[model samples]
Target chain A: MSSQSFNRLTPYLFMAPAAIIMAIALFYPLLYMVFGSFRSWDPSQSLSETEFVGLANYIKLLGDEAFRESVSVTLTFAGTVVVAEMFIGVGLALMLDRNIRGMSLLRTLFILPMMIAPVVVGLVWRFMYHPTDGIFNRWLTQLGLPRVDWLGDHALMSVIIADIWQWTPFIFILSLAALQSLPRSALEAARIDGATGWQQIIHIKLPLMAPVLIVTCLLRLIDAFKVLEVILVMTEGGPGLSTEILALRISRTAQEFRELGEAAAMSNYLLLLLMVLTLGMFTFTRWQEARAQQLNKVKQEEG
Target chain B: MPKIRLDGLVKRYGAVEVLHNIDLTMEENEFTVLVGPSGCGKSTTLRMLAGLDIVSEGEIYMDDRPISRLEPKDRDLAMVFQDYALYPHMNVARNMSFALRLQKRPKEEIDLKVREVAKILGLTEYLNRKPGELSGGQRQRVAMGRALTRDAGTFLFDEPLSNLDAKLRGQMRAELALMRQRVQKNMVYVTHDQVEAMTLADRIVVMHGGYIQQQGTPEELFKRPVNKFVAGFLGSPPMNFMDVTLEETGEKFFARGDGFRIALPGRLADRARRVGQSELTMGIRPSDLNFDAAAPDSEAMDLRVSISEYIGAQSVLICKCGEATVTVEVKSETPIALGETLRFAVRPEGIQLFDKKTEDAL
Candidate 1:
């Protein structure tokens, strides 16, 4: 090869190793699942012995009532947890964005929950929600209130509370970062313009932080859709699939029911939902960039 | 309009105090410019007056009412920041009318006020454009328009034109002067540029090292500075200082230095005699030095011209006298040659003498 051609091929040569590793580690399993999703496969038989079912697994799962119930449960959990976390997280950020003694220590302590392992968080919460020995029920009994079922009848609510407890700090730290990076002089200008404290937040702080908050919300929504280990360890999707999200359902389909093809189909459905959310995030950032470019064009024309 | 007075105002951050016992009074409808170098606490003084910062030891009074404890909104003022801190999300009209909207004013009234200010600022055509779409000069106009629409009793500008380019800063400075004439409100502006302070101030306050060096009319501060820092800070080319000793020659006083001796005028000589200091520092402005060859030796200094900076109608010649460098400003038509000795006569009345140790004017 000529020197020019070798120079052109140098970057690709350097990238070849990582590319091959990604193909084997990531794409290989993805392609295997897509291939098995179209077959009637079983764990007992090798892949060569399975028969090509041609949409049979997908059609059956679509008609299954248990699968539909789990989809609704997943949607409800994602929606409630994201909305509740956004409000509580941003509220905490705004409240703690001032200068006081011990504020740095308090802020460090606020994000500790997000650093804990998900399974450990689940177990800790599971113990906390015990009916008789739990601190919540014990306090309720002491306050003359009835001891209520936590993981039994209200299993979905209990798991949602646990998920929010572990994830709200993620939103809190991000929102605080967005808050601290805002132009400080703008706030001082607002104060001189006669904006009260609440008025400053409603008009100045929130509007200026809109872009960061929107991207953070979309990212958290995508992550919330795939939550599994916390709920699995806390309630194990018990009491008739009340808290059984799609990830847990897919695992049960493959492991307990011995239906590998149906499990792959279920996993494909979850991937589709997450893909849409990721595309939404990508489009939002692209729109922001386009608007900025248009603004620069206007400025250049004026100049 | 009400007169504003800062009575012994002090500011401290932790154990470090940034402003020391500042006492100043601004009359009704006066334009006061606090001019200083960076970190001289001019901005801190303005922020304290605007109620953006707390007064550590003293109080602020407006028309005999103590207002140091009041919030910025209750103080009834507006400020223009250095970076033109307009709301990025709001367009020109909305940004200007934000204060009125916060007060829940009528829609028509807010619209009328915003349109009036926009027309004054020549921003009518771009009223719907956001701050991001505008250029630097346009953003500066929007910031000014935002303050104008509030119709507040006092206006504070904290280096509002410093962010613009040199040409744009001059244009905005002239516009600010025009606006000052049209509006009769009390205005307090802070800047580090001496030219802005000289041209736009009804009263100029010079500060250095967290202390007020001098405060007076522009001409008074220029011609009669109380100290050495004020003398050097208030001019474009800056006043030149030469170490000189006061010599007595039969009822006539002469400032004798290394290479030149200048006769003092009667008024200055009397002031120098009253101070009775032997070792003194002599000051002369660049504009006061005239290129004269036939002038007497005692009245002129022989300087070798080194570099000539031609700036349009006038030229500033950098020359060497003995070991000290002196700058002389003359007409561009003056015939001058480089590396040649020339005589530049000093104006007797322009001579200022300061005590060498205290740096205070005699």
Candidate 2:
């Protein structure tokens, strides 16, 4: 090969190892799952022994009330947790975005929950929601209030509160970073222009922080859809699939029900939802960048 | 218009004090310019008067009323910042009308005010564009327009034109002077540029190291600077200083230094004699030194020209006299050559003297 041709091929040669690894580590399992999603497979038999059952799993899930219930539960879990976490997290960030003694230490404490292992968080919250021996119920009993079934009748809501407790910190740290990086002089000018504290947040802070907050909320939403360990440990899809998100349902479909095809189909549905959110984030960022570039071009032309 | 007064105002950040007891009184409808070098507490004093900073020791009074405790909004004043602190998200009209909108003025009234200010600033065409869409000069105009729409009694500018290029700064300075004539309000502008202070000030307050060095009209500060620092600060190319001693040369008092001896201006001889200090430093402005080839030996100093900087109509020549380097501003057409010795007659009226030990004017 000529030197020019070799130079052109150098980049591809460098990328070849990563591409091959991706094919085996990522695309291979993805293709296997997609192919297996169309076959009626059993744990007792090899993949070659499985019979072709094209569209059977999807058709079965269409009218299955349990599958429909799990979908609704997943939507409720992701939606409620995301919306509530965003509000409370952003509100806390705005409130605490000031210099005080020990403020840095306090901010670190606020983000502690997001660093804990999800399984450990699940176990911790599960013990905290215990009926008779839990700290909350024990304290409530001492306060002369009656004991309530926190993880029984309110299993879905209980799991949601736990997830929020463990995940709001993620949104809190991101929102705080966005708030701190905002142009300070604009906010100071707002104050001099007679903006009240609340007015400054509404008019200056929130609008400038909207782009970052949107991306953070979308990222959290994508994560929220596939949440499993916390709810699985707390209720294990109990109380008639009240807290059973799609990820937990897929796990049970393969391990307990021995329906690998249905599990693969459910996983694909979750992946599709997350893909939409990721695409939305990418589009928003691209639009922002394009607008900034256009503004720069106009300024240069004017000059 | 309200008369503003800073009565014994001071500022301190923890243990370090940035502004000493500053007492200044601005008359109604007077334009006061504070000129000083960087870190000279001029901006801090302005911020204090604007209610953006807390007065550490004293209060600010307006028309004999203590208004230091009020919020900036309650103080009923307007300010233009150095960086043209326009809101990036808002267009020109919105940015200019923000204060009016905050006051909940009538929609028609806010529109009228914004339109009027924009028209005056020649920014009507760009009112719908964001600050990022405008040039730096246009952004500065919007900042000015924002301040003008307030209809306040007092206006404070903190180095409002310092961010622009040299040519644009000169243009804006002229525009600001024209605007000052039209607006009959108490104005206090801060700048470190001596030219800005000289051309635009009704009265100039020169500050140094948290202390007020001198405060007077431009001519007073230029002709009779109270000390050596003010003399060097207010002039371009700065005033030249040379170590000299006062000699009782028979009948005439002469400031005799190495390579030169000049008779003191007749009017200052008695004053210099009364000072009774032999050790003194002589000051001469660059503009006051004129080319005098036939000057008598006693009244002229021989300066060796080292470099000539051509700046349009005039050129500045850096020359050495004895051990001191002096800058001389001359017309570019003046016949001058490098490495040649020249004689410049010192104009007596432009000579100043300072005590060697204290640096105070004699």
Best by DockQ: 1
Superposition TM-score, candidate 2 onto the true structure: 0.97
The sequence of per-residue lDDT tens digits that candidate 1 reaches over residues B1-362 is 88999999899999999999999999999999999999999999999998888899898999999999999999989899999989999999999999999999999999999998999999999999999999999999999999999999999999999999999999999999999999999999999999999999999999998889999999999999999999999997999999998888888888988899888888888888898887899999999999999999889888899999999899999999899999889999999999999999999878888889999998
Model 2, B179-204: lDDT tens digits are 99999999999999999999999999
Clashing pairs in 1: none
Recovered share of real interface contacts in candidate 2:
0.50
Reference-based TM-score, model 1: 0.98
Candidate 1 lDDT over A2-119, as tens digits, reads 9999999999999999999999999999999999998888999887899999899989999999999999999999999999999999999999999989999999998998999999
- Model 2 stretches with alpha carbons more than 4 Å out: none
Name the candidate that leads on lDDT.
Answer: 1
Error of 2 at B48 (Å): 1.8
lDDT of 2: 0.91
User: Candidate 2 docking category?
Assistant: medium
Candidate 1 docking class: high
